[model samples]
Target chain A: MVAFDFISHGFIQKALIGGFFIAMLCSTLGVFLVLRNLSLIGDGLSHVTFGSVAMGLLFKLYPFYIAIPIVMVSAIGIMKLKEKTRLFSDTAIGIVSSLGIASGVFISSIAGGLNIDLFSYLFGNILAINWTEVLVSFFLSLFFIFLIIIFYQELLFITFDEESAQVSGINVKKINTMLYLMTALTVVLAMKAVGVLLVTALLILPPVTALQFSMGFKGTLFISCVIGVLSVTAGIILSFFMDFPTGATIVIINFLFFVLSLLFKKIF
Target chain B: MKETENVISMQNVYFSYNSAEVLSGVSFDLKKGAFLGIVGPNGSGKTTLIRLMLGFLKPQIGDIYLFGQPAFLFKDWHRIGYLPQKTSFSDNHFPAKVKEIVALGLLSKKRSPKRIFREDLRIIDKYLDLFGIIDLKEKFIGELSGGQRQRVLLAKAMVNEPELLILDEPTTALDPETRERFFDILKEINNKKAMTIIMITHDIGTIGRYASNMLYLDKRVIFFGTFESFCNSNDMTEYFGEFAQHLICHRHDTGDIYKKSYGRI
Candidate 1:
């Protein structure tokens, strides 16, 4: 009854709905990223989001709107640089990541201290998600899920054997670019539920947990999404009752799932 | 496609990475339905040459034509199957079943949102059985042994029924018995299906027994001719030294024969 009443509140309801979708999207994409050894792309892009949000604040623009394009374009640029330059992928990501955090601190300090609104964005506030954000997050998540499902085979082939895929005429470059863009978009949208710092945990942990038990590609994919959604929902409710921060709680729940999976693998 | 037409043609191809030249003044032509064995020592531009043929890498100064069209513009990739040098997955938790991996060959040729039709499933089954891996279809690829994994990848490449099959050091991970069986399968495919095959291997004797032609490469064209001519040519003596005949006749499976024949290669 208490859980029901808590969810009956409009903001809480919105958070639950949006949180579920974001979880599903992040974990689904995470499987591919993990398989391709590109898990740090999420971390790199989320840090880029920090700079964009700060710039938006200083310019007196809606930070959400400003962060979206800036984060996405920066994500594409980082990926391109990684591919083209002599720097390794980790080095490229490190460069972008440090630049992002440094610029964000500089801009926010120039404007003033990290205010309440900016702090909320940094750490996340599930209860603060309005209906517009909820609707947009829902549809975008749905569209990305649909795209992933339809392209599972090609994506799997590319991830599994990139050289063979290129020889077989699967435009590897185009597919890679599309994946990077979608990852950036998901990181930006998932901000309200997990914030910039913890969004990568959402992207990486569920897939890592699911990989412990899954025997095949399809099994890993659906199972990852399932684990993600369950963790997010459970985290939201538990945080409400336990009076903990929702974002951190969700990440901790995901971490717990990963630990449990490790134990389960060892035992079985 | 005339029977005598060149399926792959490389004319004075030159390739370099940064400042280092990998292939300089390399030239060769593979005829239709011919089994061309590409043999070379390590770091001899064997893989790089194949990459150029597949259009994965562009040559700095040469022309490469596939089926009479330039390699860059020849878009009918469904007619070609490629198995790369590295069969090992970087990720330990690679989650793909044998059947799913085989099905990727056909899926790579299709448009997005492609469905696995009943016919496609039948084809997958046919190739799995052909590779004697039908019972292992549901097994995860990561769980399989090295030989079994190679068979699964071979099935994946054959599922599309490509006219040209290219394998790079395919027997690297296989046991001797499995390697023999693999060579037999390739020979059978080449003879029965009349498929053109280009294979890269370190085992010259084994490949020479099955391959119709040979290309001995080391950053340039050392020799390109029929296996019989390769055996008789003075170029063989110049390249492999006095043990050229021993290298051709002695199976590497016997202890240290290949190493003794090629000394520090």
Candidate 2:
């Protein structure tokens, strides 16, 4: 009866669907990103998306469309800069991230200063989920999943041993660029569920928790997705009953699960 | 030997990093199944030479060929298996099974939605069996001993049944017994499977026993010839100084090195 009551609410239903899809996409990319030691790239790109979203809002254009291309290009740019300039990975990420937040602050200040519309993008308001946003989230999430599935083995090879992958004719540069693009896209789409600031947590926490179990790569991936989806589902329900912010609730739930996983790892 | 029979050929190959020259005028030709031990002191570009041959890095000057094709155009990479030096990024917390790591070799040969055929599994099993890691295939690779992890990495390299295998300081972390066992395995792969090997190491006394051809490199081809020639040549004394004969003869005497400069004893 309680489940039916919750499902009957349109906004709640849309949030649940959008959250699940975002969780799926982020968690899948999370596994490889975590393993490749590029987890911070997710954080950096999300901040970059924040700036793009602000610019789109300032121009009265669709934010997702504007954010998607800019974030993807920035992702590849960051990787190229790191390689060509020999900057440390974190140093590159830090440089891009500061530029992102500064641009967001500057644009938002000029465009009437953190309006309700911008606030939703900054901290996430799942209650604002509309039919069009839901559809966009679904397609983006599907695209991310399909891309990863198709290049699953190639990604694995490159992530585990890049030299061997290149030597074995895997076209590592192309695959890496594709992976960066997918990660950027996933970070942007995840903003609907967790807001730009917290999207990296959605991308990293579940996979980090899954690593506690010491399962094989496939198993780890499966468990990470499960953890991600389960956290969002539980957090949404709890938020509905307790009247809490949806995004923060979901992230806190994920953190709790990570702590629990650590306990299990230590005890077992 | 015919030019086509050379599995790897480098002529006057030079590589530099910024202003520093890592390799200069390096030249050698490895035959179809010859085991080449590339020996050099630290910072002498032994690893750089291997990277050049593997096409991981390009030579700034001269030319290199793999299986008769120019290094850049050599599209057939699965034919070569490589084990890099032990000093790599290792996260013991990462969850990768031994079998999964080995299967990466096969996966690297394919695109994804990879159909893991029975043949692939058979190849994986065959190499796992060879490395005596069949029991640990399901175990976490990170949890294994350094020796066991080395074998898993080797299994990954050999899973595709490569025509050429290259290892850089593979036995550096292994104990004496494990190191000897590893060499024995290399000998088996070299003799029985006829897989050509190019190993970069400082263990001259040990590699002297296995490598058919030896390249004593110090930023260049100090000597590149048969093991017998390497032992008898004056370059041996030139490279190792007064201890050259002692180092070479130590192999027959105790099969160990007394000098730390040549690598671990």
Clashing pairs in 2: none
Tens-digit per-residue lDDT, A1-268, candidate 2? 9889989999988988888888888888899988888889988998999899999999999998899999988998888988889897788888888888889999999997988888889877766678887887789878777777788778777878777777777888898899888888888878888898898899999999998998778888899999999998888899999999989999999999999999998899
| lDDT measured at residue A6 in model 1 versus the true structure, 0 to 100 | 96
lDDT of each: 0.84, 0.84
lDDT of 1 by residue, B183-204 (tens): 8888898989989999999988
Error of 1 at B101 (Å): 0.3
Model 2, chain B: what is the TM-score? 0.89
Q: What is the lDDT of residue A46 in candidate 2?
A: 86
User: Where's the lowest-lDDT run of ten residues in candidate 2 chain B?
Assistant: B256-265
Compared with the true structure, the alpha-carbon lDDT of candidate 2 equals 0.84
True lDDT of residue B38, candidate 2: 86
